[model samples]
Target: MSGMHAATHRRSGDPQPVPPSAGRPNARTTVTRLLCVGAHVDPAFANAVVKECIGEVADTDRFVAPSYGYDVLPVLGHALIARNRRRYRRTAILISPFVPVLLSFLGMTATIIGIALWLWATWAAVFLERLITLHTLVAHLVVPAPEGGRHGFDGRIPDHAALTQIECDRINREQDGSSGLVYYSGYRPFVGAGTWQTSSAFPILLNRANDGILPPMDDRRSPGRAEVAPFTTAEIMGYIQRRLTAVLQAEEWEGQRIEELEIARRWYRTAIGRVRPVSPKDAPLPTEQGVEHYDAAREYLCVRVGSWDQEVVASVFVNLDVRGRTLYTETHRYELRPIKAAYHEVDRLPTAISPSDVRLVAAKAVVQMAGEAIGAAVTICTFPYHLLLRALSRNRPVSPRDQNEFGAEFPARRADVLDYGARRSVREIGQAPGAHHFFQDMDVKKYGDIVQKRVSELVIDFLEERNLDTGEYRARQATILNQGIIQTGSGRIVNTGRLAVGENASA
Candidate 1:
């Protein structure tokens, strides 16, 4: 979204911008519908999204968790919307004069008959049909319903926007406006399936002619030639931040486009061990404090480009350090891929109800009802085992807060007690095996190139303003910028001549 076609004429080296949402046939619709009905259809996926995306942290608190893409609220609340719509239909049908009531009665009878066939019939074919039906239903729900309802998955139908705002406010209040910092962990929230990709460093040495001939720049009175630049790291950082922000946060030319992409700058906090920001609130620190940390190499510039309603986020973290009169610019770009494929099953159901819709819904539900019956039978059979396990298990239901207050040995705040590598990323979980066409491979490359190039260019510009010789910087920039990713025989895309690779989940 940042690199629209109109901006292409601005610079020669700019990556041509393709429509961000292209190559996605009914993908957004399917995803939105799935989001709405996932709670009832696929409880596990719904729960994970709600916990990791909507809810800041998982119940078992260790690593920090935050959503990176797709407004989780609209999707999470889709179930509620669906439930309300169902309630309304039932109400209307019950109150109708005769025709609708009769139709509703017939539909209900047919559904009941379909369920009974699976639950009661002992024939192997019946059982098999039930199994297949349940499998299909578990994949997605596509119930036939009327159009233009109060709340629906149609793009025209508005979701619970006001309610979503209230819910978000409540969550913010609960967090007390401070996001947690996960210390001693290499895993990051929403970073898709790949190692963190880093660009070749661009060094700005005092004497570009002789690469490694300079003494330590830390000393005020070193034996060398010229004085330090008339700028501090903080000043240059602020300059870059402002310039980059102005460029990326373009005003929407298309008036109807809501939630235009915005650029935000935040301090990339770090410690001796691995550390990452769990929530946006945890990202920012006071400029003075941030500069202090940056001087000590404890912070980096986190330039984030959130597009498509934050469904896709490209974060380029730029770390700058001055060592021995050489200003080193190291950049790492992390991307959050589109939502999972399982959630895209909504397209199977069209907007309007048809004969096929009824058949599809009925067929899918038969096995699901049968599976419920089968599950009940299993629960009855495992009663004794469940009881034994419950009695033998030492783990009791106690909130961490309550346990700590009641004299628990380990403090709940102690994150280092038993560190687990990353449990799962909100974006990574339930993701499609490979990058979906919604976030096409081309789009990924374009976004990365534009963002990374802009960041590097800004850094070079900042150094140039300080009267630094950028001969080496320009040469390094050409090499690094030209090193676009290429696909290999295994279908994996890697940086040309570098180990850094894109988050190709299939690979």
Candidate 2:
């Protein structure tokens, strides 16, 4: 019965033990006990060694625990080490009566070493916990929040009521810190139980030398209410139109198209007004120009319109010249006016406008102008507008799905249309070449395959210099991880062994 019990304990692939007749337990039990004890102790010893090594290398109190949760390996190692130590002590006592003195000494020595190592490991763990907590506290206090305490709204807007005087002062202070001015404003109508009021202020405007006073108002009152008259729609429109026209007339557009001219006008009307004027005699006239010339004209118009602003506005002129008698007995020539105003008015005054707000308005105006120009070019040139539309539509920064759906009607490429010098410059230097290079070298492959592969390598290098790259980020990550690793005494020994192994493998 004893032999059978021993046999049951034996693991597969182990040698058989002496029979009960030989005065020993069956091979199975002996093997089973050896394996169980070794399995438990070996791991515990390794962990203790690692912990001691780490403690010696870094202050345990400085180590920070991971925020996610506790790591299981260290905890498991601790439990196994204690179990194995207990088992080893009991087994040693049981075998002392039968074992040789030399073997017994070796066993005792191993147990002592194990206890010492475990003590060191425990000390290291405590030290690491303390270190981590200290570091975490320091980090928390030092590291600034990414949003700068402001949240929910777009970063361009400011946090204030009525663009108040105090807010303006704060904005000025911030701008002075950066050697520039930053304007912010918000406009919202107020509605109450039985009345409405429009309140607005321009913080920067109050300090400006050119800013004027609000329009006159009467203090007429109802039976139980106060009243005020706001700036009317006609006055606002007239002011905007006059300022915009003046700005446009002062700027120059060498070979701008009708659509571009329209965009500039719209931008002036919507945003801060800016305009310049050009004589018809100075405008580019048709001189038996090819399709390339026409395309060039279109491109020039697009750029001029898109780039217009209060500080930098442009005006375009076109002159028609005919050498021979006209086919229809008269030359057909008309200046195209593509953009028309559809105004809306509110009873309340608008809030102060910021520069960023103006930029957004200008961008929208430029887009509108481009659309109108393409439409007119197609009508006059008697060519397909789909291709131009698709290309320009793709240039916009929006989702791929939206772009694809919007450009679905156009072909992938079109032939027989020669780009003029102006168009060529716009494509090669203004937009396509730089944009194509950026996508080709980007770690994230967002652009289509055609653009990625076709972009020049030189351009890719330039783009990398201009923008952040993956390689630099990877190097930084490696440095941070190395700094994060903790090293104790036994861990150092293991690490040395690992280094040797790695070097040998590499060699």
Candidate 3:
């Protein structure tokens, strides 16, 4: 039979049971006894060890023992009275026969006080440290923007009392009795003096209603009041790392980079100037002498005009051998002229037109006169000079078919109808080569667009992936706590007779 059944039978007086072979306690009884013994022995051992350690008192120990031993008792009696004393006197020292006995009591008292103070200091330091370091680290890692940043609730007290019954019920269903308290202290404009606020109190209390003890709302000045829930270093570090990762994955930064690249590309395109062919030479000059005299002199001799009188026109020409190429061909002529002006009139012209004003003026007049005459001749001429210029400027290449039929078309001889026809045919076949293809044409926009789009998508994806709702909840808690602390500290609610009648009056 099972032990439980056997025990039940004996309890009901159904049969006389034999004694167990060994006198051993049950599991529950054994564990209970062991725990009791351990609890008693642990303190005994610790006390013995502490006594042994402080037995050898040095000079520094002598000073501290006397001062600390006396101060501890009075301070324990009344902290305000001890604080007023400030210094320990020899008369206040406690004396005893057994050195160990005296030292043990003193050491224990000192240790307790030191431990309490240290614990209080550590708790306060941790609160401030967490506030500063956590906020700083998260801000730097996340790089939150004016537009996008992590926001959350801060758990605190008065916030706990403000929750509605339904909201409390909902919180109980979600959180398994786990809650947090967050306190924030800062300057507030509405509050005459600085104050601290507590948030997340309502949710925390609701969660705690089912299980877990809610920590006491302690004064900032009290030792036991500053209790914080224990958390491992690894857990804190993990939280920081996660927050940082979320910030780095945002889309705004990626868009900014893409915008920068586009701006650079635009500036680059503007910096590159356009390309064009060099300008053409001016028109040719006309003959100055009578037409009959110039035409006859040109066939017989290589006649040339040195200069022309201002009132009379002069002419120049040259004859060339048919077999040998002439340096100055009759088809293409060159001429130079000089102008004479009165000495006093030179100042009326441009001050710095040229070093030699007379020669400069003459050359300028001759070129102007030649340009007018040539322009008139070309206008009246049957040659298609304008068409030739237009074709050259277009830079159209001659086609293979045109080359086979008409050899090559020359710009200077385009006046020949045959050449002009051949050139026109060549141009018609070739067509102007299409606009230059560039490296940027290979859908460069695709790369930048993809990067920017993916970055944006990833940012949205990341935000959706995390629990932003929780963060917002936490932020609300923080804000409520902050406001509550300010209201409480600012003395906004007055008690009867708290203020003078003349100072202020309200119904």
Candidate 4:
């Protein structure tokens, strides 16, 4: 999307439309459910958990609740989220294929209607031409010029917002027939005013019959796509760790006790600036599409540097933007807060209490409440549509695919989805004028310069002590600084554009 930038999944330069799954491909997944990624997951631990999801997962101490879903998505840890809502240690539910496919059918229906209208107009025009005799000089009054197109049938365009809202209401609505999913992740998905609503599960599946508004990214052939990076995710993670360790050693932190060193990957949305046409004969103007995401790896290192009598601890965030070939190291300053910490222990049910039995009881309870039957009837009556989708779908995936890949093929899955959603979100929900401000863009840029300057200083200082040939040292310094790139936020990474280190040349 031109408006939303997702810096999550590393891409392979292919503009393929991805089949949507909440679990896989960070670049394409919506982050509305994201509260904050828990800090406890180390890369090794996270990988182990992913492996478990791909294989046989049992109820264990860590995963108290496991559900019958495609992949083991982390929910509130109370329920199994895929098939039916059941209470475990944390209650979760697995959604059936019914809702998402229904949304697709509705989209197709709209398209068919739109096409029918156009065809009718075309035939009507021909009939009108025949009725108007060519023999008369007053033919102009009867037959209008072909340029004046017949207005489309039911001329008013469908509101993208309303359509989106209706679809969203249908898709995530609860088992109780209420309009929203039952899970309590604190954030609820909704169709904001003028926003586009979409089912991400099947990329082009729902979009096949969209009205004129959905300008598909696949059809556009957007430009300036970069080739896949040579380094794999594992390789990149390793390199970043090595660099951080070396940097820490040079800064005289060798004796410090490493309390926590965790590696996590997050993909943030990235706005692909402008997509131009392939040739003059192609699109006349640049196309703005929906959201795209880029991947960034963050390594958190917390160290206890000072000993017994007087203890000092520090944590720094190392953000690696592998695509940009830029590394950002953000150092944080802390002030101590004297507040009591609160802990929550989620109650676990007995192992003998079957999860399926619990789910049945909950449903029975809902039925007793009266409102549940209506929602169930609406869903069950649409049985034929689900059957149709199943029969037609060649790739109806039963589970979320594993995003973990090795070797040369780094980022898995298509970073591209059709730009319709992006265009819709921006038009409807752009930041209001004079809303508020935290840190401005300029503030971030300045901070990046400072970090780059410090990095340059460290490298230069190390080289100076090494007694390497001064000429070679300067040359190496340039290469070291030039490897990757810059950006903003609470942290910024800037390239030391010059080799003159001691002074604030790069800063």
Considering every candidate listed, which one attains the maximal lDDT? Answer: 1
> Backbone clashes per model, in order?
1, 31, 20, 40
lDDT, each prediction: 0.47, 0.25, 0.24, 0.25
Overall local distance difference test of candidate 1: 0.47
- TM-score for each predicted model, relative to the true structure: 0.57, 0.13, 0.11, 0.22
Question: Where does candidate 2 stray beyond 4 Å?
Answer: 1-46, 49-70, 73-505
Off by over 4 Å in 3: 1-239, 242-464, 467-475, 480-507
TM-score winner between candidates 1 and 3: 1
Which ranking of candidates, highest TM-score first?
1, 4, 2, 3
Tens digits of per-residue lDDT, candidate 3, 229-278, equal: 33332332234334423433342563652221110000000001122111
Whichever of 3 and 4 has more TM-score, that candidate is 4
lDDT of 4 by residue, 1-507 (tens): 110112233222212222232223231111111100110112222233322222123211111111111011221110111111111101101122233444556698755664454333333332222222111112111122234432111111112221233332221221111111111111211111111111111001111111233444564533543222233333433454555455544544557532222222211121232331121112122222122323111232222121111111111222322232222223332211111111000011121335564455444444432332334445667868998998867554433343334423333333332211111111111112211223332322333333333444553343234322234334543554343454547587765332345652322
lDDT (Cα, tens digit) per residue for candidate 1, span 118-226:
3443223333433333333333234323432321333222234333444544333322212322222343422332334455566666553333456546645534644
Compose the digit string of candidate 2's lDDT tens values, residues 255-360. Answer: 5322222211111000011222121222333223112421221111111221111111122211111122110000111111111111001101123335564455
Of the candidates shown, which would achieve the greatest TM-score relative to the real structure?
A: 1
* Models ranked on lDDT: 1, 4, 2, 3
Which scores greater on lDDT, model 1 or model 2?
1
